[model samples]
Structures are given as C-alpha cells and as structure tokens.
Target: MKKFLRKNRMFLSMCAIVFLLLCTVRTMYKFSIRDYHVKTNKVLGYSPLERAMQVANYLTNLEMQKLQKEQERIDFKYCGGPCRFINVLYIREQETRAQLHVRHLAFTSAKVNRTLVLPNVSGSHLGACKSHDFEYYYDMEWTRQNKEYFNSIRMKDFVAWIRERKEANVPVSDQVLSTFDLDTHVDPSAVTHCFSGLTKPKSTFNQILKWNITGQTCELSIQAREIAMVQFLKGPSLGNGMNANEDIEVLHMEIYKANQWSQMAQSDIPIPYHPAVIKLADTTAKSLGPFVAIHWRMEASKNTNNMLPCAQHLISLLKRKKKFNFFLLTDYPHMFTQEQQEAAMKGVSSTSELSQWLQSNSDSFLMTDFTREHHEAIHYLYQHDTFHVLETEMERGGTPPDHWQIMQIPDRLKLADVDRPRMIDSGWLGILDKLIAMRSVHFFAGQKGDVCGRSKSTFTAQIIDARTIMRKSRTNYFGPKNKTL
Candidate 1:
C-alpha cells in the first residue's frame, strides 16, 4: 500500500513539470509576435496582415484606386534593399534581349540624374518599350591575361558593401514585405526586392543624401524625366566648406593627365609614349622644318562651292610668294564623290603634282609638317594618335609612304572591341586624327568646319577658317610676324 502511494506521488510531480513547460513556451511565443508587430509599425506603418485580408477576399481592380488603397503595396525598384538592387543591375540585365532594353533606360537615366534639379527641365528616350542599343558598358576594365574588359563582382561582397551603407540610413525594424500567399504572410509596408533604371550611377554608390529613404523605394518603370535631383544625390558629402553651387572656370586641356575615366583609376599614373606618332613627328621636323597645315572640310561642310577652290587658291598664293611649306589635313579624301575627287586632284599630286608645282614655282621653299609632341616629355602619350592613317592616298600626292603611312599597323591594339560602342560611327582615333591636324603653324578649317580647339600650350600657332584666309589673301593672318620652329 505504501509503495503504491509513493508511485502516485511521483506521477503527480511529473504532470506538474509538463504543465510548467507548456505555459513557458506559450508566453515566449506571444512576446515574439508582439516584438515583430512593433518593428513593422516603426518601418512601414501599413500592415501586411491587412493587405493579406483584402487579397483573401478579392482581387481589387486598379480602375478603382480608392479601393487600390486596399490592395498590396508593391515596389519593383526597391528589390529587398541593396543586395538585390546590385544583382538586377549587373546580372539580370544580361539574361535576354528584352531585359537589355530595360538596361538602356537605366543607363541614360544615370547619365542625366544630375540635371534633375532644374525645375521643368525634362528628359526623354524613355517611351520605347524595346530598343537594341545598350550604353551601360562605358567604364570597361582591361584584364591583362584575357586582353578584354569583361569584368564582374561577387554577389556576397556586393551585398555586404550595400548593407554597410544602408545601415546608416535605413530602418529595418519596421518593414514586413509580402511572401508567396495563403501559405504566406503579407506586409504592405515591407519589401525584399528592388530594381533600378535611368539612375546617375552604379549600384555600388554608398553615400546617402538623406535619411528616411527606407520607405521611399521606387519602381523600375519610372520615367527618366520623372527623376528629381532630390530623389537620387549620393556622392561624397560636400565638406571643407565647398559648395556644389560654386562655378569655377572650366579648364580641360590636360584633363587626361589629371583625372582618369575609370573605376578606382588614379590621377596621373605615368603613361607611355606612342612610338609611331613620336617617330613620325621627329622624322618630319628633321626633313621639313616649317610648314602650314590646311584642313579641308569637304563632304560634310564643303558646300557653297567654296571649300576646294578656296584651298587651291590659298596653296597657290602661299607658294608663289612666301615660299612656305604646306600640308593638307582634310576629311576623308578617298571617300569623296567622283566630282569631289577630281577637284581635289588638281591641288597637289602624290609627290608628282607637288614636284611639278615646285619646279614651275622654283622659288617656293615648301615642306609639310607631320610630327607631333611636347616640349617637356619623358615618353608619354595620353591619346592613341598612332591608330590612324599616316597619310591619305588622295588627289594631292600622298605624303612619303615611308613616314606618313595611313592607319596604324594592321595588328595594333584597338580601343573598342567589336562589341562595344564608340560614339556612333566615330572611334577614339577620329578625335586623335582631328587633333593631330590642329598642331601646325596655321590650322585652317572650312567656313563651317569643326576646329577642335587651339591649345594654350601651342602659343604661336593660329586657327582660321578657309574663307577668312581666302578673303585676306596674305601671310599677315598667319600670325606672329617673327615666330620660329
């Protein structure tokens, strides 16, 4: 009987312990749910639970935006914060042609993001739903081993970097984004996904212009014109009492030396000299001391029938009296129409017409200038000037093939790959070609030709249009009465 009583006592004690465990678990779960609710209110005041209730009852039509307020609040651009934003920006765009169209919108948006501050200042190129062009690949990284610029970053590392930045500005304590349905929880004020389009920069930008940006996530379909400067201004905060409003004198003659247009690119990392340009310049100066470089802007601006006649007259006038050397730096002569080609042939021959012109005008002491460089140089070429034709095989005799060869060697390093865009039909070499022509005693352009610019460094050189020289008809406009090479 005593043994039975002891066993009953043990059974009772076991029941009491089990009851205590149940109560503890229930209490803990209630507090956990309460904390989650509080966090949600702090972030996005809208409750996912309320939205879910609406979803369960009916699919509210967009036609009734009054009832739309009853529907789920979705943000396509937010992409669950930074990690997803970067992934979509870099990775998802590579998936399909349709996706690339979206990428282009993002690229143009980023370019014009700064001008958004101007009220009523509108932007476009956003109406099209589909486009074949892509411009986001501007900042390329050349890989030594691969000999290419196809570079990428890891998602994990990207995520960490974004988290660090957002932590300072975003409040995670409140939002409760929706998940896949009945089987899930819905939160109108919470988001775990985001997107980007027409922004002024890449996803790597970490600086936040203002706090409270967490609840203000955007959608991917937002128009480029809709973007405001206040919506996205995330560069380094202005300090040192400097203001963005300060408009300093715009100077960019040696911009290549001061700022590199690359990610993490350092300023003024010593570049190497282009061997061909150097060799050509040195050889030309040695062979022909001083000469005039006349730029013929035909084809595009050779109209009013003044370009060819004016150029020929100027060459004849200069050769007859001054006995000056001359060189032709015109647009593509080979690409000229038959009528245009014939007119050009009358000016100077491939050493043939030039030799005859010199013989007839015996006193003409002339030679063309082709070499280019600087006074103080420890071997450095900022521009790829050696990548074009040394001389054109046009109407006037082409320059010496030994020195002024057309185009760089067949296998030289080309700037743009077959895939990348180089500013519509023109390449980096086109700019270099125009620049090379400008470095002469007298740089001439058509009545409406593009003159590039006269450098402050090229002190004694003069830039003039063909019409002005033809009108003046004298060596006086050639500049500085007593200048030497």
Candidate 2:
C-alpha cells in the first residue's frame, strides 16, 4: 500500500509540471503573434492590411514618403548628392512587335500602408504586362486605389527602413520582406535572405565634411558632393565641438554628347553618342578631342588660424615633377577676415576676393568656399564655374597624357601620424600614373597633432656627392620650349 501511494504521488507531480509548461508556452505564443502583427493605426485607427489589398500595397506607400524627402534634398549642381534621381515609372502606349508593356508608380510615406490599383491598366488596355520601373515618391497617392496605398521598396529602401525599425526597437524579421522586389519584377530573395544588405561603413560618410569640426586648428575635407556633407555630419565624431578649418575638395568628371551626325556617319556598327576619352602625349595645355570628365575628391590639412603650408608642398610638387595641373581655386580674400587675412599672408592680403569670387563664378569651383582652413587642398575644388574641364583639355591639345609631370620634388615625404620624412623617388611619370589611378586624398600628421606637420621636419632630403657624377643631357619636358632631355 505504501509503495503504490509513493508511485501515485510521483506521477501526479510529473503531470502538474507538464501542465504548467504548456500554459507558459501558450502565453508566449500569444505575445509573439501580437508583437509580430502590424500595429500602427491609420487616420481612423485601422490596421495597414485592413486598408490594403496586399502587404506590398501598404509598403509601397511607405517607400513613396521616403523618396519625397530625398528628392527635396537632391541638388547635383548645388547640394551635390552622390547619385542623381532618374525617373523610372512611366506608362507606355504602342507595342508594334506584339510586345508587353508595364508601368510602375512612385511610393511615398504619406501614402504608406494603403492599397493602390490602376483603372484601365489591365493586360488588355496596357497591351500585356511587360516590364516596369519603380521609385519611392513619399507623398503622392495612386490615381486609382483610394482605399489603399503603395508599399515602400523592399531592398532598395534598406538603409532607411532598418534605421526606423531599429529606433522603434521593432523586431522586423526577414520574412516580412522575403517576397518583395528590389525595383523591377526581380525579387530580392533570389540574392539574399536578409532584407538589407547594408553594412556599417568602414569610414562613415560624415567624416568627409570639411566644416563639421570644432577644433580651432585649420581643417580640410574632400568629398565627391554635398550628400557627402551629410555623411560627414553622421560620423561618430559628430557634435564633438572640434572647430578646425578644413578643406573640402571634389574632382568633377562629366560626359558630353558628341554631335549625332558625326556618330552616325562614323560607324559600321552604331557608335555610342559618348565614348571614353584618351589623352595623347603632349606638353601643351590644350584640349585634344571630344570627351568627358571623371571627378575625384581629395583633402588637405590646415593650421589653426586657417593658413596653408603652400610654399612647402608646392616646392615639393614642383621638384617632384608630379603630373597634372595645379589650379589654386579658393574663396581667397572674402572667406578670411582682416585679422585672419593678415595672419594668413603675414598681413599682406593681395587676393582678398579671388578665391571666393572664383568659386562663385568659375565652372570648376562649386558654391562652397575653399580658401579657409576648413576648405583647403592642393587640388581641392569647392566649386567650379566651368565643369568643362574636358573642354580645357580639348582646346589645350586633344588631350595630355592622363598624367602630367610635376616640375619639382619635395626633399621628404610625409604620411599621417608619422614624424620623419620618408625617402621617395621623384619620377614624375610614375607618380602621375599612380595618382591618376588611385585618385586618393592623402594626409600626414605628427604625434603632437600637427595636421600637415611642420614642412621642414616632414620633408626628406637626399644628400648628393656632386663630385662623383658626369654631366648628362638635359630636357625641358614641361618648359615653354618643350625641350627633351
């Protein structure tokens, strides 16, 4: 009797524990489902799906809102965003070859979580569904579907979408986006399981701005465009109050359409309207032929008072025979105050308005000022009155070789954080080739935090024993006479 009672008690305890576990699991499931469901309410406090035909309809509306905001900020000639917006969505009419045609609508934030359908946009009226283009427009609504709106783009809006979800502490699973397309009918799931392929930048875009720092030292920044400014502002060092004058330089390259008549006449195969340009070997500064420009960005450091170590770097460049022209474009006189101006050139401000004025008027100079420490560089261009750099090349000569030789070389070489100048060869051709290929903006700093470092301390000089060498033939490759060695 005692043994039977003990067995019965053990079984009863086991049953009780299992029943408690079941209850806990049921409660957890209920909470998870509620969490996963879309909860944001519409104007009348309705759910997104409740107001839309499908999930995509709701998301497209979200995408449209984001695009409107982006469009408002785009200004290639002014704000200088990274890439320009190309209109993709359009309705087509005739299909001669019995082809199919499709059209896409822009999505926006104000219309997100709504349903959108086109009237008379069926296979019969649109001549079959062929292909479509998409973009998020942010504020517009569909002409047909008053009850629903378009959904935001799937992978294309990854950066914006992830940022919002992260802020709200929402757990957006990949399943939420697994079915959406990138832009056209192409699905994102074909490439990756994740909705966003975006990873953290190795160097944030905000670090590229010239004016974001607060350190009193002169600073310099180089960027491709104004969107680059936003990138720099978003960096980890943001709001650190480092007010250093900096240089923001951009190299602008562009393509131009050749005369259509010439293109049609010259081809066995139809020639493209624009072709990549190649430069010929020449010493003259003239444009050689029809071509476009490929822009680059580079930065230089400045002193605390917004002065440049020009003499030192120039001497080096001249001696080194570095290839490429050095055009000093800046807001020279206007950006600096009387005292600041005096300090820059020891109180001799001859070109008070040259830099800034040129920037405002020059094709090569953009709107930003490049004279101050916050915007200084050897090849820095804040603005350009003329983007026709290719024209300059065409008129100077068909084209100079992609690289030009600098006349002089620096005695020493300096890279960031290094104390002493390093020995480097002064072969102008080789250096030019490298610079053209890499198009990199380089900086050198000292342990004491001198941005450009003191020139004398940074330059490396070669000790030569003149007594040992024999005389050699001379050449003036870049001289007015164009003499050869």
Candidate 3:
C-alpha cells in the first residue's frame, strides 16, 4: 500500500493544483460581476448598455426639439401659414403714387390679419405692368425688421409657396388665387370667394387668376381651405378735395378705421425710400451745404403755354434766396447735351423755353451736374437687367414685349447696346431726384399759379409728407415759418 501511494503522488498533486486554480478563477469572476452591478445600480438602475441607449434617446429628443424650434422661426419669418394673403396691383401709375398705394394695401392686409404679398415696383409709368423687386425702390431689410407694422413676404417667396402647394397636391379649391378691385364702401358682408387653377401671366403673380371685378364688391373673404389674392384697380389716396376720386379717400379711411380697431399707431408706418438712396441723399445734402431744392415739374404745369411768367416767377424766387445754391428737378429735357438740347427744343417749344430759364439760372444744379461716380452708384444700385433689356428693345424701334419674353433673351445679349455709364432711364432718375429733393435744407414745389404752378402732384405731396415726418423745417436753420417756398 505505501509503494502504490508513492507512485500515484504525482497524479494526486496535479489534480489538486487544477481544482485550486478553478476555485480562484470562479471567485475572481463573482467579485467582478458584483462590482459591475454596483456601478450600474448607481446610474438609475440601468446596465451599462441600457444607460448608453437612454443617453442616446435623451440627446435625440433634444435634437428633435431644436429642429422643431428652427422650423417655427422660419414659418414666422416667411409666413408659412395656415393663413390668407393679399397682393396689390399698381397698374398705370408712377412709382410715387404706387408707393402710397402699396402702403395703403399693406395697412389693409395688417388690419385683416392677412399676409401682404409685396408687389413688384415699376420704374416707369409706361412699364406699369413691368416690375422690379420691391428692394429696387425701397429698403426691404427695413420692411422685414418692421414686420409688426407691415407683415409681408416677397413676390418670389409667394410664388414659391404657390408652386409648393401645387406639388404637394394641395386641393385646387384650397389653392384658389383670386383678384378683386376693392369698392369705395367696404361692406364686411360683401365677401367673395373665387377658385381657379393658377395661371401666372408674364411672371406677375397678382395677375395669376384673372377674374373680372364685373360684379364683385369690397371685401373678399375665403374659406379655411382657400387663399385670397386681392388687387386694387384704384389705390387709396389722401383726401384733400384736390382730386375728384373720393372713392380712394374712402378706402384710405377704411384702412385707418381698421388700424384704430387693431390699435396700431399711425406713427408706426414706414418711410418709402431705399436706405442707400436715403444715405446718398443725406451725404449729398451735407456736401451741398445749405442748398434749396426746387421741383419745377414743368411737364405738369398748366402755365407751360406761357412759361415766360412762370420762369420769371421762379427766377425772382431764387433771386430772393440768392444766398443759397439751387438744385433744380424738372421733367423738362434738362440733362441733354448742347446738340441733344437743340434737337429736343425742336420737338417741344415749351421745353425750349423751360430749358432757357434753367440754363439762365446757372447757379441751379441739375441731376446731370452730380459727379459721374455718384451717377454710376445710382446706376449700379437701381439698374435692373430688365431695364437694360427694355431700353435695348426700345432703341431698336419697337415697343418692348412682355417681361418673360425680354427675360428669355440671352443675358449676354441684353446689355450689349445699353449705355451703362449714363443714368439715362427716367425710372431710376426719378428716384434719385426724389431723394435729393427730400434731403434739401429748404424744399419748394409748384403751387397752383405760383412760379412752378401745377395741379397737386403726388410727387410734391410725398416730399412734403416725408419732410413733415422727418421734422425737416426752415426753423432748423433759423429760416422762414413756411417749410416750402
């Protein structure tokens, strides 16, 4: 028995070592499991993998919320609605009157809780249907910031929304685009709802669904599923008994009444010139140093038949204020060269007389007298490719075609014939004149029978109104009681 035990001793030692090692491994594993559970238990009773999943879910929710907030902000700025819209058509009017028209329509939109679709601005009365961006004439940034006063979206944005609706298969009834000429008396009960497949003519959205106002009345209210587009045939105007169209005056009053109902202050209405134009005017005014601006408006004057008296009256007025330089803004052919002036005089005898008067008053500066750099700046800022196209088409001895046709011409070919250096177009030049006249130390306009006599022109009225709003007066420089000469 002792010999057998000695022989098996090696085997017994090997088995014992194996058992001890297994026990040590099992104990170590058990402690590791317990430590892992303890660490996990401290973290809201979740295992490591479960806790990681929980953190991922929390971050995802935060991201989702952030995306939602961003969408809401975009919706507010661009007016992504669940809402209705109103657009104005400023046809057959100059830009000054058109600007007022827009303001009145914007007020109407605000009062009715509708988004105003800003109309395209026209630089020429002839091209009333042809339009440029709202920014071409006014400060769009100012408009955006002052959304509380005028809630609006650009013409392009409105068009995009319409296209999106069509793509999304929004019901034809839901996407109704209608036009209405607002009546003098706004009867809330006279609501009209129109529906049609959208037809955009010449890229003007307001002309989208041309429905005649043959029997329509003042108010146009659409159903919850529909959108409304209202166009004004005649725009709101200030009623001073100078014009017989009291209908516009009534419309203007309705807007004010709506404003009163909505608790909007009249002071909140925005000024109508582009910020760049205003800035340029202010700078030029400072450099001119106490100059008097005279808006002769010879084209509108009734005294054009016998302009010698009118010119004499203006000359005498300037003689009285001889201490200050004169800035003349007239519709006559004042910017023509000697050869051009002679040619123009041959066409219009009255223009020749007005030109001689303007030429005699050499102290008076015309817009052409501005620096070439300043003229270039005006050209660059307000010049549109469309203007160049129109001018080119006109110079070729043909009436300019529709906007779309003009745009279809290759971009390279449009400006080939245009004289890019000169501010030749009346559209941009009118704006430049307005801004310069607006910033003058003393402003003078034609009164009926005064030297610069004419009917009550919106151009003159706008300048006076702007000056009043800006608190521009002769009193600022210890001058006379009247702000206008």
Give candidates' CA RMSD values in order.
19.8, 26.8, 18.1
- What is the alpha-carbon lDDT of model 2 when measured against the actual structure? 0.26
Q: Tell me the lDDT of model 3 at 226.
A: 22
Q: CA shift at 292, candidate 3, in angstroms?
A: 1.5
Residue ranges of candidate 2 with Cα displaced over 4 Å? 1-307, 322-356, 360-485
> Model 3, 485: alpha-carbon shift in Å?
21
Measured on C-alpha atoms, candidate 1 has an lDDT of: 0.28
Task: Please tell me which predicted candidate would have the highest TM-score against the true structure.
Answer: 3
Instruction: Show how many residue pairs clash in every candidate, following the order shown.
Output: 32, 118, 0
Give the 10-residue window scoring lowest on summed lDDT in candidate 3. Answer: 249-258
The 10 consecutive residues of candidate 2 with the worst lDDT sum are 458-467
RMSD of 2: 26.8
TM-score of each: 0.30, 0.19, 0.48
C-alpha local distance difference test of each model: 0.28, 0.26, 0.45
The residue-by-residue lDDT of candidate 3 on 1-485, one tens digit each, is 99998999999899999999999999999999998878778866777798789899999999878765654443454565343465443333566655554565565565445666666654443111244556555666666666777687777786566555445443212221223233334223221211124322211122122222334321333221022222222222346633222122111111111111112344235445665556645665665567777775544333333344444344555556656666656554332223333333344435444444233111224533322222222122112211111112222322222221121111121222234422224455566567777777787665554323343667777777778877787311111122233
**lDDT-better candidate, 2 vs 3:** 3
